[model samples]
Target: MIQKQNPENERIKRKFFAYLQGPLGRDEKTIQKHADAIAWFEKTTGHKSFKKFHIDQATKFRTQLQTATNARTGKPLTASTMDGQVRMLKTYFVWLSQQHGYKSRISHTDAEYFNLSRAERRIAHTPKRKQVASLQQCKRAFDLMPSATLIQRRDKALFACFMLTGIRDGAAASLPLSCVDLDEALIYQDARLMQTKAAKTITSYFLPVDPAYEVCFIEWVSYLQNELLFGHDDPVFPKPEIAVGENGFQVAGLSRDFYSNASKIREVVKSAFTSAGFAAFAPHSLRSTLTRWADKHYSSREAFKAFSQNLGHESVVTTVGSYCPVDEERQGELIRGE
Candidate 1:
């Protein structure tokens, strides 16, 4: 039997979401995650009222979540996934406990029941190694891509741009031609003009990956300006114009508009790598690739710090802690005092 959503619970949830957005300054994606976590708790408790939330309810919800299987995967949810959901619920209840109607019924102490065990928390926080493409591998992929047609040229350039700039795919997709300066080899990720993580205005200089990448990007920009007459405000990598023909909808050429999002840009990257007989590495992994490259090439601490800054990180620690990982071979060599 389907359970109906409680109107009172729905009203409070909406209020909480607004608080998260207005006071907490959370983005849409984060607010959605919070909503999902709250929905999960409500579903487990048969849409119980937030005003009636109790420690016992939270305890029951945790137990049920632990045993729950993902509908899509048919496998038990990972410790990290469960941990995140519980953490969100804990935060929500903590906030709820202070609200006018929920104050007497819910207490801050009650929210502790939503926390996962310490063992599960450890698993959730542990950092796993990510797959990052090497400079050589990226170059090989670029070489393998055919750039005879306009669409092909854009694809090749977009792939090269990721390696050259180490820009996040989201920022890259929304960049206008004016944001990139070929002479300076820099990208201005203006938050007001484009979508950036945390709405940060980041100035990212091109990393010293390979000159070929810079050359490819520069040529593409020149073509956009000279041949296509694309203005400074035009997207660096425009979405392809699709129109109906005898063969039905097909790509005609380039449009002077940004991609709706980074998904299509990621698709171009994945196809390039797979075509070159390499595993499909997302464009974001290029940041890690640049980090690894800097670790090898930059000998001085100052030089490395500057490189980290070029990647739009305010601190070198953020760059190394997040992107730098010791491969098995390197880890073994260090352990052996080699």
Candidate 2:
């Protein structure tokens, strides 16, 4: 059910969304997090205005989040999840107090109550190893892919691009033909032209993976340019078109536009991994896979630099904190002998 409509809150949401898109320039992931937090707060308070926010409300939500269980996992929510949701609200309200018509009702200091305890934030922010797929696992999945249909070709191309470039799913979805220079084995992730993290621009040199992996991407690019007669300025992965056929509803062929969302890419990845006999892994997991690969091949600075550029991160430290955790098997091997 919709909360009782509050004009002020509704206006604030709109303003906040625009602010997020404009000044904040946050990634979709960050924007969505803020939206979820604001939605939860609106639901709790019946769409109460920011002017009515109080310390008690903030403290109570913290307690509620602690007791909350994840709907799918059926376990207590992770501290990271709770921390992000609460922090988004805290930051929003702090900004709200500085806005016109709300200075008296809200205070910048009031936002501090939204923070989790220092112990809780530590638990939330601690680095943990991710169980990313290994190079061997990726090769298995690729070998198992059946390239018999156009959809299949696209699926194979999707995985090939990701496995090689390690670009985020959204950036991959939004990539243009011109962005890809198969001749140079590079992707020009120009931030002015692409929706990259922090809107940072960089050229991603496709790392040397399997020879077959290189062929898969090169062939796909050629197919799009030659067989499909697409120019150098089209979407690398256009959305699928739907049509009514003799057999009723079906996806017929390419839609004339790129995907505005990354859902299709994620779906293709899940299907490919499942068909290859592995449990499902999200498209984002491939980043950790690249990180794992980098750690083995390069020393600390080199590894960090490669991982940072791959993820469009400007700082090596941020890349390490955000994405470079080694799996347990690697940990054991390193510890066992040395």
Best by lDDT: 1
lDDT string, candidate 2, 1-338, tens digits: 76577877888878887888888777777878898898887777777777888898888889899999999999999999999898899888888888888888888899999899999999999867565677888888888888887778888988998888888887888888889987788899877767676677777888777778779888988988898887766888887778999999888877658888899989988787888888787788887787667766666787658657766777877666666654577579889975
Q: What are the Cα lDDT values of the candidates? A: 0.89, 0.82
- Number of the predicted model whose TM-score against the real structure is largest: 1
Instruction: Give RMSD (Å) of candidate 1 vs. truth.
Output: 1.5
Worst lDDT run of 10 residues, candidate 2, spans 318-327
In model 2, the Cα lDDT at residue 77 comes to: 96
Candidate 1 lDDT, 223-296, residue by residue in tens: 99999999989999999899999999999999887987899999999899999999999998888988989998
User: What's model 1's overall lDDT?
Assistant: 0.89
Q: Candidate 1: where is the Cα deviation over 4 Å?
A: 1-3
Q: Per-residue lDDT for 262 in model 1?
A: 93
